[model samples]
Target: KHRWAMYIDVSKCYGCYACVAACAAENNVPIGVFRTWIERHVTKGGTVIFVPKQCNHCENAPCVKACPTGATYKRTEDGLVLVNDDLCIGCGACIQACPYGARFFNPVKGVVDKCTFCEHRIYQGKLPACVETCPTGARVFGDLNDPESPVSQLVKKMPTSRLKEWTGAEPMIFYRDLPSEADL
Candidate 1:
């Protein structure tokens, strides 16, 4: 079984927003909402840091538990946090539960929506939209179970950090060389 994970090398990112555009286009994301977005932080020393934000696909997802209708759930096979449009009630519980602010109610569909790591494309042997369009190759995706996978190898070599680690969601997105402080 392949456990999917994403590794981001922040040092390689240049805040081009190419990944953001690519993700929106590929996912058909609506305006005023983002399946993936980038946050720019300027340190005290004036160095700019770009932190790309998306669904963490948490191992202990609060959104999954908060969804009253069981619309939000994590896949046991690959740990992808997915929304079932049929089951969603637009209650906004998932949105409120998510600390990462990665989900939203799609008014067009009357259901909650969020990032799935482009699992459809992954099944077709393609990278996620964000990863594919990253000009600097800052994004990496692979099976964490595979020792030779880039994500796995990066975790071994890099000092990685996850967003809100104290919350214990066990976020699968790992960042290398990330700024210690992230601003919205």
Candidate 2:
């Protein structure tokens, strides 16, 4: 499987939100339900900062294993997490099962919705909308398994983190910056 990874350089990101808009427009993500979203971990006495986040597509993905139906699955070839809309029952079990809160139930589609790493764009050998449109050049995407990929190089060069490391999800998304508490 291709090692998929996203690197977010927090230092470069200044909460501009171009990535958020791009994800919404490119994927037609619903208003209330987002395939990709941001989580601002504010800290340092109201000194707020933003971190754009989405599915990490973990190696041990709970969202996939918890689906009572065979709707959520990871592609063994590309390391992409996908939800089979046809197989989804809208049970919402996978929604709660996700440690990252990445899964959203789409009432219109009657299935779970989350970032598919821009599968449509990936198929065309294009960057994910979020990464491509980030005006600050904060987001980088590549195959982590490939040692020479840009993502892998950045990860090796900087300090990075994934949320909820204790859960052991092995999230592929990485953050180079984070907010300090007290701003919260």
TM per candidate? 0.96, 0.92
Q: 155-184, model 2: which lDDT tens digit per residue?
A: 999888877877877888988875543112
**Backbone clash tally (model 2):** 6
Residue runs of model 2 more than 4 Å from their true location after superposition: 180-184
What candidate 1 gets wrong by more than 4 Å, as runs, is none
Residue pair clashes in candidate 2:
43-180, 43-183, 44-183, 45-182, 45-183, 46-183
C-alpha displacement of 92 in model 1, angstroms? 0.5
lDDT per residue, candidate 1, 1-184, as tens digits? 7788999888788899999899889988888888988888887778998888899889999999998888788999888989988888789988999989999877777788999999999999999999999989899999899999999998988889998888888899999877767723
Distance (Å) between predicted and true CA of 78, model 2? 1.4
Please give the distance, in angstroms, between residue 162's alpha carbon in candidate 1 and its true position after superposition.
0.7
Which candidate number maximizes TM-score? 1
